[model samples]
Target: MTIRSRLLLTAAIGMAQPALAEVTLTRGSSPVPDGEALSTGDLTVQNEHLAFTIAVDSQAPWGVPRGAIVDLAPVTDGEIALDRIAFADFIPNNWSAWPNTGREVEIVTETPEKVVIRITRDFGEADIATTYTLEEGSDRIHLVTEMTNRGDVPLVDQMSGFTLWPDSGYILPVPGLAGVDSGSAEDALSDRVVAYDEDWFIALHAPYFDRVEYASKDLYATHTLAPGETRSFEGWLQVGPSGDLAPVVAAEIARGDIAAGSLAGQIASTSGPVEDSVLVVEKEGVPYIWTLTPDGSYEIDLPAGDYSVYATAAGYSDSAPQQVTVAADGSETLGFEDLKAPGLLDFAVTDSAGEPLDARITITEGQAPLVEFLGRQTFFTELDQVGGVQASIAPGDYVFTVGHGTGFLTEGEEVSVSVASDETQEVDVALELIARPYENDWYASDMHHHADQLEGTTPPEYVARSELAAGLDVIFLSDHDSTANHGALAEIAEMRGVPFIPSAEFSPSWGHFNAYPLSLGEPLEIDTSTATAAEVMAEARRLGADAIQVNHPFIPYGYLASLEAGTVPGGFAPDFDLLEMNGPDDDDAVFARAAQFWTQGQRIFLSAGSDAHDVWNDNTGSARAYVHVPGGVSADGFVANLKAGRAYVTRGPLIEPEIMFGTELRIAPDEERSLSFDLTAVNGLATASLIGPDGEISSQSFDKAPSTATAEFSITATPRTEGEDWVALRVEDTAGKTAYSDPIWINPLGEPDVLSQD
Candidate 1:
């Protein structure tokens, strides 16, 4: 007999009952209480090795119990672990939103071998029924779910699965899975299953690692259910201690019988033919990988079963999955072709002088964005293993929008292109580089960024290349709490002729700060490194940071904000030189908080960064600081200029405001100043304000239309009562983009210049 059959017979003989055991189901308070969330139901199930409480609770979404606290622990001689595993009734795609746990939970059957519990939740147009069977002898649970669509419309691409969190341990991917990290909290996506091990191992028979919640990993499957039809699927979870996974994996391999079958497909591409493309074949929810032929055709040998097949490539829109079924044992052929293809978008960017210019491109159809490449300065015209600006786009009518940064300005062009099947269209974009007041001396920099940190493995060379592509004059390699790749990236930066700033992100629970001129030999730990923010800031200063900038001060755990709430140990703020006022997107709250601190007499310089991780998905220098490095651009020189407060941070809009007096930009008390402003933007300016210690002293509205891309302003102003009253220029474009200049301080009427100026 098979091992499973033999074990079943033994278990039946030892534990069989004369009749079904009486199961008394009841609703009670939460078994594992954490907060003020309302409880739905509590269930207790015990076996020789495990005792778990399935507590249902309502949190986040209203009127629904979405959280399933699987308070599970190992039981030894009736004793259980203090820590328990808690999870929720989470669907992989619904990790962000809480999924509804049915209005009622009931125990339908109870026996020595199994306990079957049924849960039903009513949707507005449909309802879902999930039955969980907790079996004896093993910690594995069988989940059989059925969803009936009662509405007229058929539901498509529905993802449903459990979100589980084990108390401890990381998830190991399945063998031979061809996928990368999903870039969420989840560590990875596997082809067949994911295993979690702490003191014991729990294997989930699901294909995708959806996300991570605290210490737990979410595993799920995707399906489509037609209206008035019932769709059903089975999921399994097996558990054991240490060396017990061999049999489990062996059993699963046996269950998935190897069948002889062949798959054929062709990729439709307008750019001659698709090469180096991939065809993903998911069999019974497990993804199997295969490479496509050079002419966009593919053939695969797969096990006999049902499969969902799709095609994918870089810069191409993903194709819809085609369902196919194969016969077991016999040679069968399945065809998945005649699908719509993606077109090729080959474009180049340059300045009016025929020199490459860093720019951002957006391809959109009506209101839907197709492909977007932000902060792209250099274009690679050659084709090789690694890709360039060339994109394989979906066939459609798209509007191409392009904009430049810093020394370059373009009203932002919009060209309409109709992409047809199997065609390569080449387009050229030329942006005009305007010579501002300090044109030859200014250098743009993004001080905060990350790569290959937990989520991705973006290499050091790619990092340097991304910086050049974004047209950044300088980039600081500040991976979170680690400077592992600083030296390697610095070498690449040197090769690319860009200044590299060696830095580390002291990302602590209380706050995050960047330390420059990083010493790699020094020890740094995420936990137990520094107890308080004060000590961490002190450590950064000791590490030779010319000036420490508070990162994202308005976000959660942001230093200045956390300090205000007294969350950090120290009551007083740290002695930092700069404040990050900009990131990928504009946050008015961050700018307001920084301005409040400065207006309250704090000496702070403003800075900006893209905070980009994956350059393919993000824009480098979407927001950047332009430092006036008149002494020539060097890492030390740039840091010195930042410390001297001779810089302005901008997003899209370009503004050059100057107070023509001394090179130091200083004036005596009540001194008259002749100010000149040269501003140009893809979106014209709305208003320009001159802010002082007591708030706005004067403001001017540009007379040009909101769409006007360029303008200049020159006006004179005088300091009223100069006791540390600093004057700064702030401008806003019609599109709500902003730029901020460093403040020029007016010395007190009788006081002498205070500290040594940069």
Candidate 2:
């Protein structure tokens, strides 16, 4: 069936019940006969005769291609195995849609978030699949597949599956998944199996996670499907021998994220009113025309033969799929089944000027059943050029609203429409001025990054330039005990018009929390070879800087130091800002611990940063801080916000918080008060709440569901009456984004002894 029918089915079923669509595929049936399929095919070593590669054998019936499982180049005396070939009795399903020739599995059953393919296996069919390996010659890369026929009569099974080896580097073409690669020398934690591109670069993302074990040198990653099932996928994977897959790949292949592939060979067609080239046809989906006021047609290609077509658009009733016959190399004329353009809902959004507002515009459906359309990308629709944009929607009535700044929309503006499929619905939009969404919102930031001074950029430049371009509101010039870029960036930020925080990544020769922000030239004065974290943080605070956090508290290197040890540190530098949440540096356990730290109130803020730096921008700026300044676009405002603790950091999401006792400035922690503020979001949905000064204190959750929401959170904080009063909120989104509000300055009912001042 075509994707049009599937989307329609989802929409209809969605209105009645909550459900998510899943894809399935049948057992492998041999399509092409296996030839000399050498048990030991080809083998070679490259990369200055360091890495190794060999043709994999077809053994277990799990789905993965027959190629060099390991580059074998990065390691000395590395080995490759060509184990058994056949069907994986263990796979037990048709997760491998095409059973034999080396298929690519972009989304697998393990991590069900992406476009997934699962196999509900039925043992009764004589289904077949294949699995292979080239591990340290371990059995993990081997395949054992078989076909069974249980019947009174003879049953012939023809199974087919494809396996394309991992490439050096690849550009994933999925809607949201981008540049990705795995397998590299820098993979210290060993969380990956089939590394995508090259090697030899220190790249890490989402580090603080659950598990940090080196994915066994002999790792198993495959996908399979069962009988009478179907699977679908888009994009491609580039398999090669030499490239960096060290730290970041746009998308994680995940535990079961088998592989990435191309949509190049899929069958599809496009049609609408007016043969306007403005709308270039993309991919294998049908376009259902609701109102074709002026019908137009386009061309499509199908492997020389009989074909079927389904057309659709929003708000229009789905039409019955049509079957058309075509001759080879032929062009056919197809028009909008119902020729008419949906009434145009066009608008010229502009700044205060009667002139058009030149901000990005997005039209999301506000009439219930909302879906996500934005992530990583800055605009709702592809920004083709400067000023103008046009979009096509189903003629059904819609409440269209547009947003430009990082704030809320001007309430959903309902627009009714009635136009022929061939007609254009023109409702020119005029965006008005509104408050900046992140204004006054607590923004979080991390002051470290390393852009090796080699690849046309340095660590400080990574902290300064690429980060700002990718929307990181704050960054510190923290290099590996190197002050080279801090001074350089301070001047460059001034010349290039960007913000730069002076800092340094001080390491004691031993690998530990190496990042600590400092004044531009601080690194030059410190003897990092002998300094302790306490001494570093002490100097940071002594420099009149605002805050300092213990970076990647869980990463183990020399001394086997843990976050717990760093926290007590002879009580030196005890009072501080945070313990790096280090989302990008975490393994599974690290991520869980980060969450636990927030819930338990570790006495320090939870922060995340991207420890990214590679020849390529792998997960570059994947994790960053979002400091909520006054949205006026000034350095002073940003600095004040940083000192105030109004910030959040993440690979995605935005937030804002405010606290008050009615109108009085005295919203003492000892007294309760009414609190309110706006929460603006993009890229991800999140949960937020108010927390007392104590980290372990129970807080309130957002309470309301936000769909482009401008919500009010009112909670009372009966703060400690004895101590200097302070109340704040902590938030984390479903996507792992974390933020901390700067403690609202509350008048302490009494003063506690500070040992020195008291």
How do all models score by TM-score? 0.56, 0.40
Best model number under lDDT: 1
Model 2 stretches astray by more than 4 angstroms: 1-446, 453-465, 474-476, 509-530, 538-546, 555-576, 584-607, 614-641, 644-653, 660-672, 683-687, 693-704, 707-725, 732-738, 745-758
Q: How well is each residue in 340-363 modelled by candidate 2, as lDDT tens digits?
A: 233333444443445443343333
What is the TM-score of candidate 2? 0.40
Show how many residue pairs clash in every candidate, following the order shown: 7, 164
Q: Spell out the clash pairs found in candidate 1.
A: 68-88, 165-216, 186-212, 270-422, 270-423, 358-377, 359-376
* Candidate 1 residue lDDT tens string, 1-758: 33344435766875764422222233554333232223554665556555445545433211123324345454445444432343434342333222232456778888776778877765435566677777665555666666678889976755556654443333444433324333232433232343333244555665333433322344455556677988665666655543223434433544554334455657654444465555666555654433345467766555556778776554454566788875543333343343446567777767787766545566534222111121122233321211226756656677866545432345556767887657899877776654332355778777777766423234566666556545567867777666667778777667656677888777654467877766643545423122466777777877777778888775545676657646564555557877887443435556565566555566667777777765545566667787877767888888878766778787766665454111234444544555566666656668877766666667778876353333333322344542345666777888777887777665544333332244
CA lDDT for candidate 2 = 0.36
